[model samples]
Target: SGFLGFVALNSEFPQVNPAGSVLLPLLTGLFGAPVLLISAFSNSSNIPRQERRLAFPSVFAALKGSIAGFFVSIFPGISSGVATVVSSIGERSDRGYIVTMSSANTANAILCFFMLIAAGRTRSGASDALKSLNLVPSFQEIAILSIFSGIVAFLLTIFFGLLIAEKIEKIDGRKLSLSVLVFLTAIVLLLTGLQGLAILLSAIPIGLSTHFLGVRRINCMGCLMVPVMIWYTG
Candidate 1:
C-alpha cells in the first residue's frame, strides 16, 4: 500500500504542470483507498493459524523487511537506468551506459542471492538454539496469535492514519521525509541483501513452520538454510 501510494504520488502528479498538480490530491486519495484495502486483505491472509504465535511475528518482520529491500533495490536501479538511457539518447551516445548499468545490476543481483544464502545459514544457527531450549508454540496457539496480531496491526494503522490526518494539512512535506527515509533504508536493506539477512528472513518462515507444524526448529532450519549456504558458498 505504501509503495502504491508512492507510485500514485510520483507518477500521477506532473510536477511541471498546474492542472496535473491540482489533480494530485484527488488522485492520491482515489488510488490510496483501494491500495490500502488490498493490503489489509493480503496481510490478513498471509499468516495462517498454525504459525501465528511463534512464526507470525518473525515471518511478518522478515517479509516486510524483504519487501522493503526489494523496492529499495528495484526503484533505484530503474530510476538510474532510465536516467542513463535518457542522458545517452540526448548525447547521441552508443550503448555504453546501458551495458555498464546492466553489468552493475547483474553483479548486485548475484550479491543479493548470496546474501540470502548467508542469512539462511544464520537462521539455521538460530534454529539450533531454539532446539536446545525446546521452546515451540502449538498450531492452535499460533493461529490465535496470528489473528490477534493482525487485528492489532490493523488497528494501529487506523490510529496512525487518524493521527496523521489530524496533524498534516497536506502530504507534501511528509512525502519528502518519507523519500529520504526510504533512501537511507535502501542502503541498510542493500547491506542486508549482501550478507546474511536474506537467510535470516527465510529462517523466519522456518521458525514459524517449526512452531506450528510440530517439527523441530533445528530440522526445519537445517533443511531451509543449509542448502542456501551450500549453494552460495559452492
Candidate 2:
C-alpha cells in the first residue's frame, strides 16, 4: 500500500521539464538525505577507524556481478541496485558483497556504452546524453575507451580509499553528514527552485519511514519503478 501510494503520488507530478528532472531531488530525498539524517542523529554516528589494508575479493563474486550487470544492461526498467542484489545471491561475506557491487557498477557502466552503440538503447544518463548528441562511438573505440577508463578508475579508487582511510578518523561523522544534507538541499533548490524543494521535503519523510519501519531500503525504489512500469505497460 505504501509503495502504491508513492507510485500514485509520483504519477500525478510531471517528472521532467526544461528546468530539470525531478530525479535529482527525488533520489536525493530517498537515498541521500535520509542516510545523512540518520547518521547525523544516530548515537553510533561516529565512524570507526577503517583498516588501510587492501584485499582482493572472490573471483566468483565478481563473475556473478559481471553477469548480472550484462543482463541488466540488456533490459530496460532494471536498475543497478537490483543487479547488485541479484549478484549477491548466496554471498555470505561482507567483502563479497562489496566487491560484487563494485564490479556490477563497473560492468553496468561499460555495458551501457556497448548497449548504446549496438541497440541504440540508453541504459544510463551518460548514454542518453551521447545519444542526444549523436556521439555514439564505434564498438572497437568504446571497448578501448572502457578498458583505459577502467584501469584509471581502479587506480584512482585505491588512492582515494587509502587517503580517506588515513583521514577518516579525524573527521566528525555527524557534522559531515549534516553538511552533506545541507549541500544536497542547496543543490536541489538551485536546480529546481521552490517546487523541487517542496518535493524534497515531501519525499524525505517517506525515505525516513523505511528506516523506522525496518523495511528494506530498496522498497523506496517504487518511486522510479512504479512510474516506469506504468509508462511501459499503460
Residue 78, candidate 1: Cα error in Å is: 22
lDDT of 1 by residue, 161-212 (tens): 5676554544444444445434533442443332222333333343444445
Worst 10 residues of 1 by lDDT: 47-56
Which candidate has the top score in TM-score? 2
* Superposition TM-score, candidate 2 onto the true structure: 0.84
- Model 1, residue 107: distance off in Å is 34
**Residue 155 shift from truth in candidate 1, angstroms:** 2.7
Each candidate: RMSD: 23.5, 3.2
Name the regions of candidate 1 deviating beyond 4 angstroms.
1-137, 171-234
* Candidate 2 backbone clash number: 0
Error of 2 at 72 (Å): 1.8
